[model samples]
Target: MSQSRRNFLKAMGAASLTAVGAKNAKATPKNVLSDDRFGVLVDTTVCIGCRQCEYACKVEHDLPAGNIDDYSDRSVFEHMRRPDHTALTVVNGYPSEKDKQQQVTVKVQCMHCDHPACVSACIVGAISKQENGAVIWDESRCIGCRYCMVACPFQIPAFEYHKAIEPKIMKCDLCYETRTSKGQPPACVEACPTEALIFGKRYELIQIAHERIRKNPDRYYDHVFGEHEVGGTSWLYLGSQDFSKLGFPDLGTKPAPGATEPIQHAIFKFFVPPVALYALLGGIMWLGKQNREEEE
Candidate 1:
């Protein structure tokens, strides 16, 4: 083989080794969720589809503060909407069998998982789970790769696709900087007229949720939506109908990252896969060189 071919082969081998080393590297210390962590209980049955929470979230986040009256427009409920870069939280209306004419509005935002997959997927340490149970993203540290979007089970993280430069990963932080850190309720909870959203310590909230379910057995589903989903989320939900009707995924009691992490770690640590990948690429390059030489 020519000297250039030898050098190319050596480069590919080195790259394969480097890739394996990077993938097999030790992860950062896991951020454990405290029992005293703050959380919110969203009682969907009581929610009037007012969209006051959406307006409150926007105002608190310093996003577009449109006329508050405009939020009352129920036409927006025609389609299911996800939290985008422009809006951190959105209240979606789901049909209720109990109420034929009216739909139950459920607020959608970051679940702030106890074992956050976004934190694990973020190679740049952009995302973090706060002790208060808020999952926040640091724009300065974010590489805008959108891995967090893929990692999040709820698909909470949204990228700023419109911005040409320095776009941000946007999601709910549970108003940690504005209110939760100061022991005040989030803007949505505070602004809720119907007391649909209750904020307190996560353990306390879970107890309250169970009590409510027990008291009004006919009013709510027996299970709290986030209590054990994805190893428990900071935000819990209660609805009369099944959560699947409210667009919530049936994620089961197991944590999302638990099933995937081991497989991902082994793929890189074993080295066989990366070596084979590089070998295939190198072979293709060699074939291209041969074809070019024949033409010459």
Candidate 2:
């Protein structure tokens, strides 16, 4: 690894550790800072591949509809399309039966990692992990560099490619401003006809997920997607077959993107390193100036 990357990782030590501290500090801040608001829990095994949620997202956000007229069509899906500017959420088809082409689809959107890479990669701090579980970006603060796009491990955090002015990071915010703030679910979850997507407290949802698994372990995978991956996630997944089979990469338990900041903070931000560095530089400059004056 390069020196900068190595230095960054060394500085990020404590924040990356899984070991409990003297006490487990509260994680209820925001998606980036901590888990503040509640989040959605998606059980892929139950998802019916209905795109009502996608249509709802476009309508809620006032985005122009691009490709499909029929929400249920599986044709365009032969190609993998992720969440993007026009489409805040895209359901990808995962072929299950090798011979029969029995497919299962998982809805892709911001996983809303507890340590969101989008929040850290953003230089202007335009994007913030809200006190709620949502990661929100203020367009006014955005310079449109698209670092958030590059930092996301899930490859989420889409940008407004069409807008010439006041463009911003465009992705799911769990409808924090509209639905979640009002104590209602997001447009996508609301539009799901089947109980495919459920919204509630993260703790409660974990319980519900476990119950579903215990009832029918044979029907669902034994693993929970977002629980401990890179610290935790507001959104989670439960699938019947292997997650990889459904376009889900086996990420093992690493925190998702934007995770480095907290790690950065825990190690480097504690001692006021900036102040120390400034002091050191000031001392050096002063010494050099004094030496030059003596020579003159």
Candidate 3:
């Protein structure tokens, strides 16, 4: 082959490879972050049903600071309560099978998932996963679509339904702007007297969870709740019994994004191939016309 022809073919091959690489890259789902992101480890056995974490979360968020003493009432645990606009976090009591009189308390809030479904589902880009492992919402960017609430596997996001105007989505932000950004632990973690909640780097917390489980196999179940659920979350949990009994959903290790991305990609790919093919043909036709014009 002529040297020029060989060079032309090589250039075309490189361009085709680059195009394929870009397509494959876009098709792949977002990967898990391996960086030094913050996380929390919750040992359910250590939680003493004090509800101090709930009170601290309220105070930190500047919510109704009703007498802190009122939070001591265990009657609230009679029925399940979730995090709402007024409260960013809630501590719930589950009847302990070992002791019928005693109830195990577990704090509920946004899990700050490594691959957050809320971030993926937000049509207006209202929700985002922070570098420090916080899944946060921007009210200014929100159009009140409420798609995020439907998307979350944990059902963490709560909407301000009472407000007639300018309602905002509410959820735990991992205290990113208030404490975590300033190198401080979350208010709830700080308030836990029993050290039930351990706040640190995600990887470090996972190691600690494993160590605790290994040291006292009888005390805790072998599984670390957030290590692989929905492609891993920043909030880790250790339970003496099955997590499902503690009100945690039994989500398999498969990432939630896997379900949504394929449909979305299929729609995009359906349109993209035709558009790209047209552009390529148009370019070839244009080149041919230019050559003819040159000869004329």
Candidate 4:
């Protein structure tokens, strides 16, 4: 091979390695879970299906929260709803297994995993898990890759596909910026008329959840939903029936990243994939052909 060809190959190899290293470093999460980090305990038994928390979340985030009274219309509860770009947190009603006449209300939002998969999936480091147990997104840094949306076990992160410009990935940030940072509970927790949502240190919340289950063995399902799911989450839940019956996914105790990170790291460590390598070599060969043609 020509000296120029050797130099080109060396440069391409170095570039590929550097790119892989940069991506791996950027994808790694910087934040560590703190012992003092806060969490919310959602007691579904105490919830009234009033949808007050839903209204509060919208109002706090300055979303298109129509009249507060509009949330009282129970017709919306007939169909299941997930949090989207407009609403970061939503209250969903499910029929009680024991009594079809009675309804169980569950509020859903970002679980804010102790080991957040979204943080590990964001190539630009746009998504981060804060020390206070809030998983937040930085719109300025986000390239709208939607990797976080795919990584999240709860399917919480939402994309603004409708917007043509400056679209956002939206999810509940635990009211970190507006409420928790100032030593206030999240708007949803505060607005819960039945006081079903309790906010406190994560560890404390877990203890409270278990204690509630212990005292009212018949009332609770004897399981704290988020205590061990996806290596624990900041949003713990207490339910009358199994969490799955209330729309919660049956995730394993292992962190979501634990299942995929090793494979990703191995691939990146090996430099470019086969397809990328072929594309790079093809480009190099085409460039060399052009150079030889110019000389002729």
Candidate 5:
């Protein structure tokens, strides 16, 4: 084949592959909401600010876990904290609206949304909503895009900014790989002394949350925090006061990706844009060559 023809063929082949990749990147996976998927119900009202869950999480993930007794320090609760790279979960203390002397503790972690924005935002399918109700991240597939961090409504995904090599997007995975996949509760749930975090089926947890609120209306805020927020979540919450006061975002019933996915699908539907761009580039090359030959 002629040099110009060979070059054209190579360029077209690369463009086609690029186009295919673009289409696949935006393709939404089947939204899985299994009836028997496991979940954790966090009773903020029952938490004691012990921070055992935090310690357990660190140990489980092989992070820099300090002495277990160190978690007994209630002073850490003085300032509100969120989950970060060092700790996948953290407990924060909030003043009880009902009682002046008592404080309510809330364990913060990934909500593992039923319709995860991270999974949808990922350009490389690095994040996935598992059948077991865990929104897990595959480090192997992650290209350090940090889209998951931006997409999360709870702002749960944490990036390892300090690591120069293979920095990770860190968050709670509900022990899917280490425990739950083997039919065991997460390290945090197992460590809670007060049973504040209950691990069970997602549907069952919702039922249990409502039952608690129904039986003790005065103790609960009359709403299960994660039951419907962003189209529900695997990590449910029950609190004494407004969730907003406890540092929870007030989100709507619609899933975070609902507004954007349709538009994305439309744009990438037939891979028309990539193919057109490729063809246009080829035409430009051909025209340039023709003009040069005429002058010669």
Candidate 6:
């Protein structure tokens, strides 16, 4: 209320505004910059669950001969299974009443979600979303905390518990080392003699999926899983029955579990806070120096 008090408050307010303005001057980087590379699109309508793909994955990866249940031999078919620490990919049998014996075999592995949560979960930057959209993990950088497994909405990433010596995060890296990096198709797609698993550009795969549904409406489900669901996966699926009945949950068009980076980006206007802090300190120190000079 007094003149001196009013002037002091006004100066403080003006200083804050200047700092805020300075902070806002920098541009923020966008998090959703997608890559042009493509990936395998599993057309579930065609997979027969021959286990050949699983076999190929085993030989290629070169693990112990056979798993206790299946991973030892990669017999994902021996039991209805999901991809785990040992098995990178598993073909599960889907029995639909609409097309009985359609016996749709869906190959379960990393969907390689476009906006991946695994990448965000890792404190060491061990998990990365590849250019082709395959979400891969680097063991060298991993701490084996298993947060990635927890962060994945699909529960795809698995950890290697077999080794008490030095276990690590274990899951499909989209066969990056063995095939994709060489400009060749993945083992699963290659092993499918029936052309069930098709690997190619993501957009092209969606077109192929729609084509199959249109050709035989009675044989295939009208919807294509992973095309838009969970912000779209590099790998996709099709089936005679609804995806949910076959264990695929009802997911939204939004990016799957590990894709919440946009939310982070919005909150962390990276340079803004630092710049503002600097401006405030600069003004404070400048004022202190001015006061000392006046005293002198």
Q: Please tell me which predicted candidate would have the highest TM-score against the true structure.
A: 5
Query: What TM-score does each of the candidates earn?
Result: 0.81, 0.75, 0.80, 0.84, 0.86, 0.72
The C-alpha stretches of model 3 lying farther than 4 A from their native spots are: 1-32, 268-296
Number of the candidate with higher TM-score, 2 or 6: 2
Model 2 TM: 0.75
Clashing pairs in 4: none
Residue ranges of candidate 4 with Cα displaced over 4 Å: 1-31, 270-296
* Candidate 5 or 4, higher TM-score: 5
**Per-residue lDDT of candidate 5, residues 1-296 (tens digit):** 45798899999999999999999999767547869888999999888988889989998999999888888888987898889999999988888999999999899999999999999989899999888888899989999999889889999999999999999999999999999988799999999999999999988998999999999999999989889999999999999999999999888999999987888778877997898899999999999999999999
Give, for candidate 1, the lowest lDDT window spanning 10 residues.
26-35
lDDT of 4: 0.90
Clashing pairs in 1: none
Judge candidate 6 at residue 195 and give its lDDT.
88
Instruction: Indicate the residue-level lDDT of 136 in model 2.
Output: 80
Residue 174 lDDT in candidate 6: 76
Pairs that clash in candidate 6: 66-72, 66-73, 67-71, 67-72, 67-73, 115-259, 116-258, 117-258, 230-256, 231-254
Clashes of each: 0, 8, 0, 0, 0, 10
Q: Cα lDDT for residue 215, model 1?
A: 100
Worst 10 residues of 3 by lDDT: 27-36
Q: Tens digits of per-residue lDDT for model 4 on 182-256?
A: 778999999988889999999999999999989989999989999999999999999999889999988899999
What is candidate 3's lDDT per residue for 153-177, written digit by digit as tens? Answer: 9998999999999998999999888
The sequence of per-residue lDDT tens digits that candidate 1 reaches over residues 1-296 is: 45798899999999999998887786555445777789999999999989899999999999997999999999999999999988999999889978798898999999999888998888788998888889899988998888889999999999889999999899999998989989899999999999999999999999999999999999988889999998999999999989898999988888888877888777768687889899999999999999999999
**Candidate 2 segments exceeding 4 Å error:** 1-36, 66-69, 97-101, 257-296
lDDT of 1 at 32: 58
Query: Which is the winner by TM-score between candidate 1 and candidate 3?
Result: 1
Q: Evaluate residue 3 in candidate 3 and report its C-alpha lDDT on the 0 to 100 scale.
A: 73
lDDT for each residue of candidate 2 in 1-296, tens digit (9 for 90 to 100): 45797788876786666445533575443333432457788988778787878988998888875554587787756888898887889888777643255677789998887877777788788887766678887878888899889887788888777878777688888898998877789998888888799998777788888899999988888877788776678898888876777787666676664356666676666577888899999999999999999999
